[model samples]
Target: MDGLHAPASLALGIVPRKAPALDIASIPRFWFDNDPFKTRFFDALSLLFPEGEKFFIACVRDYRANITDPELQQQVKDFIYQEGQHGALHTAFNDRLKAQGVQVDRILAKQRTIMFDGFRGKLPKRYTLGQTAAAEHITAIMAHRFTHSDVFASAHPVARALFAWHAVEEIEHKAVAFDVLRTVAKGNWLIRAGSMLQVSVTFPLHVVLLMNHLLKLDGVLPNPQVWKDGRRWLLGAEGLLRPMLRDYLDYYRFGFHPNNHGNLAKIQRWREEFAEHGDARLATDRTLHG
Candidate 1:
């Protein structure tokens, strides 16, 4: 509309699938590379989704009436279904974590308290959507990175499938929330940036809290090597964050838009792989193969 983002009728092509047949009951506790840090790193993120998606859906739905465009309104519906399914599957996955002695309910309770009690009732509606938009961007970038990040090279097939499915959907609809934000509260890049700042800090902080708890449970909390490797894994020269920092920083640009960071090929691969119920290993980025 402003020569910045995609058009209102962008046809996001969001396809919400029935729950994937993830055999959560049998997944190894250390599903990612058999390392506690890697496994719980994503597991902790799973803890965020159910609550996160709920908040994200609410933020978008609250402003739905303001969206007069039929295409965007339809995208919003598909977005809700897609995000809702993500939360459901993650919840199923998180519930499975309890079998591994993770105290998932307690962790979920903490997240719920923070979202429902702490912010939902208090934050202004527009800011909530802004934060949602910011978070979607962060997720879209992270989802994009996962496609190529070595962090997931040795990740179990089930775990890989979860991330891959979630990633594709995130990429497809990445613009919806931000477009909604632009529609209802146009030209609020500052708020988008502020919300990005808020989510950027809070998100990793919560993940750290979760990883700490999970590691302590595994009796790996005192392992200096885990922390060292993790810092290197995330912040090191060739680490996950290093390669992704530029994309993350793009959110601050005056004309930033998710469309500018497209990864359609990867999205198509995952969609095809999952549609046939093939092991998603083929759909993952080439990093896994190389």
Candidate 2:
């Protein structure tokens, strides 16, 4: 394996095996509860999913074409399965927004047209994989920062759990795509470098676009609460970005190792939190309608 190291592999030896299918059933319910700010944020995120899903699907398709190692191919297949479930869960959540009279379909349609179909011809498979790797790195960092921050810690129980669950999985699978590309591409720095560059650029652009969408949807552009929450979220990005960049450099120097351990204690804490307050019935409730 291109990025595998014995020491790193040993460190990760204790990490729990990931299921082939994500337990979408465990996704928290409080995420749906109506607070104007939270709902606005959810709507903005919903808008991003169609494009994100397409991007993942594209990368997975490309990998299927190029990958030859059976074990690595199986890992990629598992990653795709989990990503597809993510798309399904978010799509369901988007439907909830539409139920609340949000203009979700129109926005997603436009995003799909532009981000998926329109850009498909311009971006090549290697570039797509690079972007995926970059996004994964960004999410891994965000997962770490979110576990440590009070902003996430103090949120509604369900909201906090939702972010943490996603974060844990991000950390768990962070190396999968990079491993795939490293194996197939073999010392291809364009994918690695391009991914890093795109991560730095596209993440902020998504945030800006999200804020703009939220402002137009809720007419809360100037609301103090919006600014306060937005500021906190942006500040949280620093914690995520710094360590992630460090890890990216480390990966280049040490090579990709699947055995690297993250803050597993945090994942445990989040699971414990979920067990305490997470009601399966409540989480499954569609009563909120949005």
Candidate 3:
């Protein structure tokens, strides 16, 4: 593969200097309108463990300093915008939990101090690029899972909408990270191999910990009913994993292309949903009886 042909992974398009606008109000409402269980799940997880957002912000900040391509820089900026919106929305959700008497500030504080403070210095450009590539690949698979599974089907309409919307964006920018990595670190098979391995290990670990934390916070950690419901929701989702990892592994096999396998039609569908019901209320009447 000609290294020059490697499209900028961070490039959203050929457009230059476009600032990313986030619909923040559209975010927390989606979370609130989603399934009560899932909302509680995400809320508890976000409040107790805020490291994911810190990691995302750190990666984006690193890319800002490291990526040279103008178009790629814009895409990275868009990504940072989306991630920042997610963090802000989740923080609000965490606040709601605290208002309801959930003590999560200490947990989040510890994570912020440990993770964000630890990564304050500049990172190696190549390693940063590789990490971004790996993260994008993992998020792409998660987007697919969100779309394909019934995990969010019975969720509150707005919650389902939020996850669906986030998934579509993930699909939209899925190639940016890989494109950037290939552009800056071409011919480095070791970096590619190492990224793939790290992704394989970390994705599952993160999910497991998130789930465990949620269960513990909900007082369902020892409940067999919770396991049964969770098992049913997760059983068929394994199929989403292999294809993503396959793509990650095969990234170097041919010319790296951005228009690879993204679901544009699905993205359009999400746009329609957003236009139709984006005005939904931030609070829902749903209860977590399930």
Q: lDDT (CA) for every model shown?
A: 0.79, 0.55, 0.52
> Highest TM-score: which candidate?
1
Which 10 consecutive residues of model 2 have the lowest summed lDDT?
281-290
Error of 3 at 274 (Å): 3.7
Residues 130-186, candidate 3: write the lDDT tens digits: 665666666665565456434454555544544455555666667666766676456
Residues 1-290 of candidate 1: C-alpha lDDT, one tens digit per residue: 12112222332477766656677676788888888887888888898899899999998999888888998898999999999999998988888778778888888788888876877788888888888998998888787777643456687776777787788789889999999998766738778888889989999999999899989999998888999998887789977777667778878998887777744554665677666754554455432322
How far residue 136's Cα lies from its native spot in candidate 1, in Å, is 0.6
The TM-score that candidate 1 achieves is: 0.90
Query: By the TM-score metric, which is better: model 1 or model 3?
Result: 1
lDDT (Cα) of model 1: 0.79
Clashing residue pairs in candidate 3 are: 9-176, 9-179, 9-180, 34-156, 34-159, 35-156
What 10-residue stretch in candidate 3 is worst by lDDT?
281-290
Score candidate 2 by lDDT.
0.55
Q: How much is the lDDT of residue 161 in candidate 3?
A: 46
Note the clash tally of each candidate. 0, 2, 6
Per lDDT, the best of the predicted structures is 1
**For candidate 1, what's the RMSD?**
4.1
